[model samples]
Target: MDPPTRSWSIYNRTEITQRYEILERIGSGAYSDVYRARRLSDDLIIALKEIHDYQSAFREIEALEILQKSPNIIVLHEYFWREEEDAVLVLEFLKTDLASVIREAKRNWENGISVGEIKWWMIQILHGLDACHRNSIVHRDLKPANLLISSDVVLKLADFGQSRILLEPGFVTGDEHTHPHEQNTPSQTWMLQQPETIPESDNSNQEQITMSKEEYFKELDDLKAKDSVDETDKETNFNDGDTSCLATYTTSDMEDNPFKSSYSYEAESEGDRSGALTSCVGTRWFRAPELLYGSMDYGQDIDLWSLGCIFAELLSLKPLFPGTSDIDQISRIISTLGNLTEEAWPGCSKLPDYGKISFGKIENPLGLEAYLPNRSSDEIHLVRRLVCYDPASRATAMELLHDKYLNVNPLPVPVNELRVPSTNNGQDESSPGQWRDYKDMDSDSDFEEFGTVDASTTGTGFSIHL
Candidate 1:
């Protein structure tokens, strides 16, 4: 457990105060670098991630802290800002990830992954999502690369940079996680260089009216002033007009309660905590429609959408919607599910990102069924329902687990049975109880400290353990 030595300075602006005995570079990324460090305290190996962007690192730390109690989440043991060095994250490591498996499957066969493996993988992902939802955390970024598989096939959700712990708004602390591929790719380039662009509407009628920059600013200022006045009036007349507020403007107005006064202070505080919770989660592709459409408030159902996508990827061996851009992704969804109708667009005009696409000219309207030709009819139905563009209509994580599609298929093996045994491979055994076993190498103590346990070690030659 000595710190790594500096053969060469890492140029990402992260100063190395004390040399960590420079083990091989485990992984690198656009914004940060990861190294396996041996803690001097107990010689306990831990994953050390050096992050350059202060805001994003903070977001990630917050997420890990919020869910540290959950076994399914990668543990963030310690974090500290070093005045002379880069911000550091100390984490528990796992063996493999779902992304590596999919890549391997694709590498072996151009046709991609088998249907059976995909089903097996999805069930595990659902289990992980269920855990996150119960804890009231949203993994805003859910993709193959972020999911780490242990040697035991115990999948631990990693990378919380974009995740948020759905607590009260004002109390929020900035902490976010970054994608692994983004970190490991070449320095000069990135997988996602820019936020995906929202495409212009092909339909002229739906285009936003062209406003000069000055006019746009003027209109924004006017709206801000109007909103301020409206808030002031509402505050002044709260007692008299609480019930008269418009439905669109209404939030749970349960600040006053007689029952709370009857309880002890601790009980009352607990009740208050239960009453105040609301948030959204999932990546753009996996984002529930309600969040993207700008619903004022949302909840964990957004994460369910991501579960559906994970289910699909584990089954299909590719991203369900590999959208080139936001516009393209939306079109792919609309093309699969048919377009939004007037019934679906109650106040679409007010949405900032809403614009027209050729829903009217759709070549096929059967939606998900058209794309999932290989799937059983029931499975296709489940995906469609879970990934519904409307957040309200999307299925909850618990509901999805109980869906007939999951239950009807050859059900998953008990997590223990399917899990790669530690004895089966020696790599994970080095850490004993600390790491999960994937069918990978026999000796991996070197990488254990960095939160990466190579599950592809079973001499299986690059397998997806999850």
Candidate 2:
């Protein structure tokens, strides 16, 4: 039995007949089922995130609206809800996610995705994050799978279910009983009738929509060329907050989850469970020290720490701090970052849950460079600034964007040239920065589906498996 809420836009195969041609189930996560559906109007294929929980769906809708103009943030097309049925979100369809890309890169190349690509992806993420911060929103969950890539290879931030608005009024307000009408839609209705960001077989709009090589390199040089960071900025450090990132703040499942289906149940309160939100948030691998202390008052600084962890992972091809539990997470952080004292992290002993964990007295010489020996020193320095003990010292998204590493000689591959984990065919489609002709694809299907698609050219018969 369905919950007494709203009707699902395209509940089953039958519902998609005239409205949308349901191609396949792209994915299913904790909150909703993501599908690749083709709009019958112009044969435009879009992603439908069908959500059963209205609150989660509502949050994502709200965030997307505020972040619609953000360069690398995912674009929302239209949204609707049918009471007692489901809430359907119409969004630009993306080919694969960063997680799938990472997996495919590891398979194709033993070393994993290149450093330039990592820097490129991070720059895009920072732009999206900066946009979120400017809009007073916090994406509590940031992971590989949540970052989707278009067919043209542009990366965008997706999945705002766990995001929180820092605006004065906060998430939802106003009278609940007020019925939604055509003129007066719900607060989450943010539909923009703009051209689809992710194009399908519509080659006519390729040049304008596709990410160009010049644009790609120019964007990479943007942050660095925009400003300068002094020695004080680089040396700024503190340790007031405990460095134990409540990696398992909510549950053990957050250990290395790609923000897919981790949050199944609520978490027990630890400390200072008042203010903006609870302390139980973030994934194990990318959590910050202050978050581990159950500090509900923490701000966007926590995200910088997570970004550092992510940046390090991208370079190393594995998580920098792979802690299974809260205590283990803290220890891992301390071992890599070294123990903190009151002199460094002022008022460290005063935190609510301080001294609850222990670690080695000194740090290991086999530091970040041990795994990333070949990477530029500047990149390593940037990562160190991000994963610092003091949240106050961590660089903001905008600041990190200006780091010199992004402007280095080996520029990131352009969008058309950037290939992902699931899309790596043995054949070279074109030069690194150019795209393959859409007409040449085996006439089997209008679009390609990940995971199940076979790389065979000689076969006579064809099949489309969702």
Q: Name the top lDDT candidate.
A: 2
lDDT of 1 by residue, 276-374 (tens): 221222344454455444443556666667766766665555556544333444555666666655465455445433442223445556666555667
Clashes of 2: 21
The prediction achieving the highest TM-score against the true structure is 2
lDDT of 2: 0.56
* Model 1 poorest 10 in a row by lDDT: 257-266
Stretches of candidate 2 above 4 Å error? 1-18, 169-261, 264-275, 363-366, 422-466
How well is each residue in 1-466 modelled by candidate 2, as lDDT tens digits?
A: 2322444346543444457766655454334666666888898878776765444555676677656666588878766553344567778876666655655564567767776788789888888888777666777767665677776677788777657665432322223422111111232222222333533344352222223334433432342232232213322211011110111112222222233222321223321122336555555456677867656667778878888887886776656775545555665666566676676577666666665433335634346776566777887998888878877888988888888888776777676556564431221323221112211111111113223332332243232211
How high is the CA lDDT of each candidate model? 0.46, 0.56
